[model samples]
Target chain A: MKDVSRLKSVLEKGGFAVTSECGPPKGADPQAVLRKTELLRGKVDSVNVTDNQTAIVRMSSLAACCLIKKAGLDPVLQMVVRDRNRIALQSDILGASAIGIRNVLCLSGDHQSFGNQPDAVGVFDLDSIQFVQAVRNMRDQGIIVGGEPLSHPPDMFTGAAANPFADPMDFRVVRLAKKINAGADFIQTQCIYNMERFDRWLGIARDRGLTEKAYILGGVTPLKSAGMARYMKTRVSGMDVPDQLIRRMEGVSKDKQREEGISICVETIERLKQTPGIRGVHIMAIEWEEAVGEIAERAGLLPRPVIDDQ
Target chain B: MITAQQKPIDEIRGMLVPYKRILVLGCASCVAECAAGGQKETAMLASTLRMKAKMNNEDVIIQEHTLDRQCVKDFVVTLDDIIGSYDAVLSLGCGAGVQAVAEMFSEIPVIPGLNTEFIGETRAQGLWVENCLGCGDCMLYYFGGVCPLARCSKQLFNGPCGGSVGGKCEINPDVDCAWQKIIDRLSRFGALDRLETIYPPKNWSRKQGGGPRKIIREDQQR
Candidate 1:
């Protein structure tokens, strides 16, 4: 209950505060990170940093989160306990807090079988919900993993992922509430495509009291081109794209599809911002975060106030 | 890729011909790769054992299990059902693997179905042959990396005697003289300086030692 007043205030601006994602470099280089932050520094409220993002090794999320903090931008550190045991998770949380990294997104992470090392083994020691609880245990009790008291305990805002479009989506809200009860400070959702269906899920989420328990961040991704739209429509599952968007995409030339894309993304943001009960929008420009601010401004969603004054 | 090692299938069937219950345990790593005993092998053995038992006028309860690794403790810790349900184990891996099973499960007698071969290397498709003697010390560096301890017929330090003809060993004309191959390879690499230095008589105690040898890596262990 230490004032989340600043974070809530940041979201109040821009009507639907737009946040963007940036993937760290494949190797240890931090240049890609600096460029992303520089491009959208003041345009967005905070930046979301991905962890190994899709089973490929890169710069660690904690290191990138530290860099983002040094760059004077708020960071949402993503952590996956798939490869690490409880011992590693506790230490990493402390490491992030030692620096100024505050927000953390708990995830079960991609299955190792899907990575380049297919023959390699997988270790799913703890799921996202359990990870959130361990972070709470570390913060509230100041207890070390071995039951000894640590000199300093970390204060991090923990969050978890939710996908309303997933099969048996009913369980998603149920799990989201479980995460909040487990001490999640906020919830950043999976990419949203069908606003109507998502709005209906909001009803389920509202019934469970997820709205008041944590800051809910609805997610959006800009389809840069028709191929990008095709990739989302075909490659990613549990995503429901309305036919109207696809039909509109069919009329545009492949060369000009990206322009049409920016237009479409602007419209999606415009509609979501107007939807009741939605707290904020998490923008996934899919590597084109440069377009995020422009899309937000074009959608007439700029000039947002931090947190809801109502 | 396939062979029987621990208490042969027929032998176990013969012993349990009068009994009404039978169980088969399988290992999935080494044995599975060799195609001798794994999940597939266990299912096959179970069905065959059941068929043979029924033909001889008896009903048998047969069960099959394939543990991830029988040698490792973590993989075998969740075996409460397996230990109590089975009458015997028909491990089809090497002698070390069968011994591991016996050491872990002492109440029930364990049987071997396959003859455990020496530490082997795959020579071709579905074929494996012994390559090393597990000698305590390696002498390959002096012989141009060709090990006479394994390939040479007489384990000769300096060889290809007068009896050898056309680079073939005297004892077996069909087998190429391993020492001749070594000399040819060394000469090709122009490192024959290593060959002129004669080797001392082989040390038997350090290698082929009577007791098991162990490597204790202090840093690695922790």
Candidate 2:
């Protein structure tokens, strides 16, 4: 609706937009990003280039997004405040737009302690809300943070992350509202394995009319094995994988676990489609990029609509 | 008050490797309250250092002293008469106290024996929780006396991040989500609406900027 990118047009045209992620390689290997982009090329409407996702060092998100754009896929550049101050962040945002990257997701990334370089200092100069608000100011007012006018502001579709399953669940909806009020045009939430809790969260979101304010994309990651399911349930913070789903994965033989994981993802996508207030699904096939095509096909998201005209 | 904890015995011994004579100095104020760097702690550390040195067949003299407040110049001035006796001053006070002692006795080496933690209160017996960042500004009144800056791992002012689980922080299960406490307290006081007002990006200049901060009162200054 904002004439930002094809993904925006698809969502505006009432199509169930499918998006996925591509974690850039740790080194400067363009082929790795190109290969992942090729796997997700036609299956999803856009791809999110993570900014050192989980605080681990990787190729810069802007560079990866540029590579994705070269491969003919729309890249949603993810920017985290954990590693950069305001000056670097604004410079990168403008640089991303200069390179034809349109969608940008603002996030307060995982703390450095969780990363390999635990001794690294975190520069959380701005929180996620402040980041969203700053980006919106740059886009609409043609100004940088501090009221400094920009010669040509970046025209980008601003997106943010939402976690429906984090603690103090009652306050989650309010936080989402705050994000929307701060000018988040779209929201891609944390991976969804607990549909009931997510549905409940969506109910509150719907009541607050946040669904109308921002396009909500439910996150789904296909579990590769029983071990993966257990890890998601126990180790991943803010994740809500149910015990029943883990048991279902454990009940299957090792050979069938992968297939079961796909089925779970398909079922999740189908349920999310039916759930109110959610406009689309974001598939984070985390190192399992090859399965994205199959998951999208099985989940009935194939033939992604082409809405080039904004 | 400024709270701190003693460095491990092994770590303290490592810093004292080069020195034969040392003064195990302690502070009598905040560190004493937290049971960290007090008169009793100084004596105990002096004894341990002496015993450990003897076991290693090393000759050393460990003197113990406690000041009213090691951060104060007047309290640190008491060391002037007895300065030349020790090779180093192993300050059992907080970082501020250690710096003050180092400044007062410029010629002698000052080694920190305790890690200055934060401005906090003793929650219980042998328990202390950080309650302030000394951000140079105070916003506790707005959040029902619960400080998000010190309590929240992310220092989020709007609300809880998605990483909170069961009222615990994403970083650790032991940490209570600061937003949860703020919301609960605000709800009890019927001041939950205060949270709806979005806080702008913090002015870090006032909190941390330029060189070291200083406050002078004309009335108190001669």
DockQ of candidate 2 against the true complex:
0.64
Docking class of 2: medium
lDDT tens digits by residue: candidate 1, B102-218 = 777787766666576555566677776555666787887788877766665445454322223456654455666666667778878987656543354355556533577666799
lDDT of each: 0.68, 0.90
* Model 2 alpha-carbon drift over 4 Å, by segment: A1-4
| Local error of candidate 2 at residue A82 (angstroms) | 1.5
Candidate 1 per-residue lDDT over residues A1-310, each given as its tens digit: 2323234456534245556787788877788789888877766767788987766787888888788877877788888765676678888898888876777888866645445655544443455666777787777888754467878988777777777765434344655666777778777877777888888898888887778788787888877776666677655545677777777887898888878888877777777777766767788887787888787678775664444332
Q: TM-score for each prediction?
A: 0.60, 0.96
In the range B131-194, model 2's lDDT, one tens digit per residue, is 8988887889998999988898877777688888888888888889998899999989999888
